[model samples]
Target: MSEILRKGDIGQAVADLQADLRRAGYAVERTAIYDNGTRDAVAALQGATGLVVDGAYGPKSRAALANFDVSRLMRESDLIAAADRLGVPLASIKAVNEVESRGRGFLADGRPVILYERHVFWKQLVAHGVDPAAYAERTAILSRQRGGYAGGAAEYVRLASAMQIHAAAAQEAASWGAFQVMGYHWKALGFADIESFVATQYRSEGDQLATFTAFVLADTTLHRALKARKWAQFARLYNGPAYAENLYDTKLARAYARFAGEESEAVA
Candidate 1:
C-alpha cells in the first residue's frame, strides 16, 4: 500500500521534487503547488514500477527521485547560452554536466571551494592565504589555461560558494540563484568584462549559471595536466601530493578518464 511519508509541510517537499523533475526535463509546473497532474505523475511512476499507485508523496517515492534524469530538465537554449557566458567550450560543458549530475538536477553537495589540509600548504604558497587574493591568483592561472576568462567577480562568487574546496562558505550563497553566484558578482562581471556576440550580458542569471558550470569544469585541472603529463604538477594543481594520491588513487589519468567517461554521456 502507498503511504504518505509525512503531512502538513509536504508542500515544500513536493515542490522540490517537482522542480527536480522539471529540471530533469520532465513536465512539472513551477507553481510550487502540487495538484492532480503532479499526483498522477507520482501515481503513474508508482504504477510503472509496480508500487502501490496511491497519489501521495512517501518514502518509496522519495527513493525513486534518484531515477529521474536531469538532462531533460534544462533547456538546450539555456545550456548554450550558459556555455557562451562562461567562455568554456560547449563540448567540455556538456561533458562535465553529464558526468557530474547526469543532467538530473542542481548539484547535491554544494560547498565552499577549499584546499584540503595538505593542499592548504601549497595554497598558502600559491594563493598567499588571502581569501580573495588567493582566489584571484587561482583565477589568473585558470584563465591562462582556459584561454580566456569571462565571468569576472561573479565567477569567483560561484567558485567560492559551491565548489567543494570552499564547502565552509556555501551557506553565504543562500541568496544566490541557480548557479549560486551572488547577484553583486553577477553585476560586476558585466562592466568589468567586454562581452562579444556569443557572450551573454554578465548580470544575466542565465549567464551566472553557465559561468558556475565553467568553473566546475575547469577546477579539475585534469585537462591541463593531461596535456603536460606531469604527475606532480597535476597533483599540485588539484590539491597536493597526498590529497591527490588519495583522491585519484590509481593515477591522475585513470581518474580523469573515469570522469571524462561520465562527462561524455551527460545530457544538456
Candidate 2:
C-alpha cells in the first residue's frame, strides 16, 4: 500500500513516479509538476494493467506499477494497420501522432486528454435550452484560465465541473484523445454518437489511432495532404490558421523525416 500520487500533488515522489511511468513506456514529462501529461500517463498505465484507471497512483495503482512491464504497451503493428487502412504513409501517421500527442492519450485521472472549451460548452448548453445564467459564473472562471503549449490540468478540472452541469453537451464541447479530435465530429468520423466516440477514446491508443485514421480519411483534403507529404497543407487543415503559431508544419516535417529515415535504414 503505497501513498497516492495524484494531479496537483507535486513533489520529488511525483517526479519519481513519473520516471517509473516513463520507464513503463508511458509518455510523461519528468517535470515533477503532476500536470496533464502525468495524469494521462497514469490513466494509460492503469488501463494497461487492469487497475482502476483513475489516474491516481494509489495503493493498488502503485502495486500494479511495481510489477509493470513496459514492453506490453507496444503498438507498431496497429500504427502500420492504421496507415494502410487510410492509404497514407506510415511516416505521415507517425508524424501526426508525434505532433498531436507525442503518443500519449489518457490523462492521470483515467479520462481522455481534453481541452474543454468553456465558450463552446456555454453555446451548447444554450442550444440545448439550458439557462446560460446557471453556468455563467463558472464558465466565466474557466474562460479566464489559459492553456500553455501542451495544455494544462485546469482544462480537465473545468471539464469535470462543466460535465456536472450538462454531461452530454460538455462531452461534445471538448476535444478528445491523442489526435485531439473534437467530439462534435463523431458522426462525420463514422462514430454512431458522441458517447460511442468517447468510449473508443478510452479503449486504447490503438483505438485512438483508428479514430485519427477515420478522421483523416473522411477529409479528402487532409488525406491528400498527407499522401503528398505536404506538411503545411496538412497542418493548416488539421490545426487551423493558428498552426503557424505552434510551427505544427515544421514539427510534422521533422517527425516525418525521422520516421522516414528509420524506414529507409531498416530497408538498407
Candidate 3:
C-alpha cells in the first residue's frame, strides 16, 4: 500500500465499510482517515470473517471491503424536513428510526396483526397504566397515561406485525417502525395523541419520525447503546437489531448509499 491513500477513495470506502459493520452491530467512525479506530474495525471484521487479523489496508482489506456496504448509513433529509416542522434535530429522528424499523414499513408478515402476544402488550400497558382492551372502564387514567404513556402503540404494533412476529410482546415482536418502539411505551412518551399533535404542529409523517428521533436521542438508554456499540444489546433494548438487519437488508443498504454519499468507511 502507498504511504498516502486517496482521501476520496479512502473516505468512500470507509463509509461503505463502516455501514456494513454498523448493520452487523459494530461501531465504526465515519471519517475517511486510516486511524486507529479504522484499524480496530478492520481487525474485528477480519476476525468475524476468519481472515488474517492484520490492520493494514491492503488488497485483502480492499476485497473484504466489498462485504461492507456503506449505503446503509442514515440520511437526515427526510428527518431534517420533519424536524423543521416539529422543531427538533434531524439526528434525533434518524437515531430513533434507526433503532426502530430502520425506516421501513412495520407489521408482522405484512399483515394487520398486532405483532406481539396479548400478554406482552398487556405487560407494557401495565407499565404505563394504559389498557389495550377494547373498552376502558376508566377513561381518565387512560387519558393521562395516553400522553407520553400509551401513544404510538397501535402504529408500532402494526409495523412489527408486518415484520411477522406472532406474540405481541415476544422478543421477535419487541421492536417496530423506524423508532423501534417497544409496546405501549411510545404512547407514554407523549405521542399518544399524534393526530392532534400533528394537526396542532402542522406536521406530517416526517414529523412523527423526527419527534421519535428526538425522543431516542434524548434517551440515556439510546445514548448508552450507541456508546457501547452493542447492536444486539441495543436491539433487545428496543427490538432485535439482528432481526431488523434481516428485515431491512436491502432497504438499509439503500439508506447507507443515500446518506453516506461517496465516503468510504468500514463497519466493525
- Per-candidate TM-score against the hidden true structure: 0.26, 0.68, 0.34
State the lDDT of candidate 1 residue by residue for 169-207, as single tens digits.
332222233333332232333423222211332233334
Q: Model-by-model lDDT, in order?
A: 0.42, 0.74, 0.43
Task: Please give, for residues 74-137, the per-residue lDDT of candidate 3 as tens digits.
Answer: 2334555654644433333343344354333222233211233334443545544644464333
Check candidate 2 and list the clashing pairs: 39-107, 39-108, 40-106, 40-107, 40-108, 55-108
Stretches of candidate 2 exceeding 4 Å from the true structure: 1-74, 131-134, 140-154
Using TM-score as the measure, which candidate wins?
A: 2
TM-score, candidate number 3: 0.34
Best by lDDT: 2
Model 1 TM-score, 2 decimals: 0.26
Cα RMSD (Å) between model 1 and the true structure?
14.4
Clash totals, every prediction: 19, 6, 60
Which candidate model has the greater lDDT, 2 or 3?
Answer: 2
Error of 3 at 206 (Å): 1.4
**Candidate 1 Cα outliers beyond 4 Å, as residue runs:** 1-72, 83-89, 101-188, 191-208, 213-268
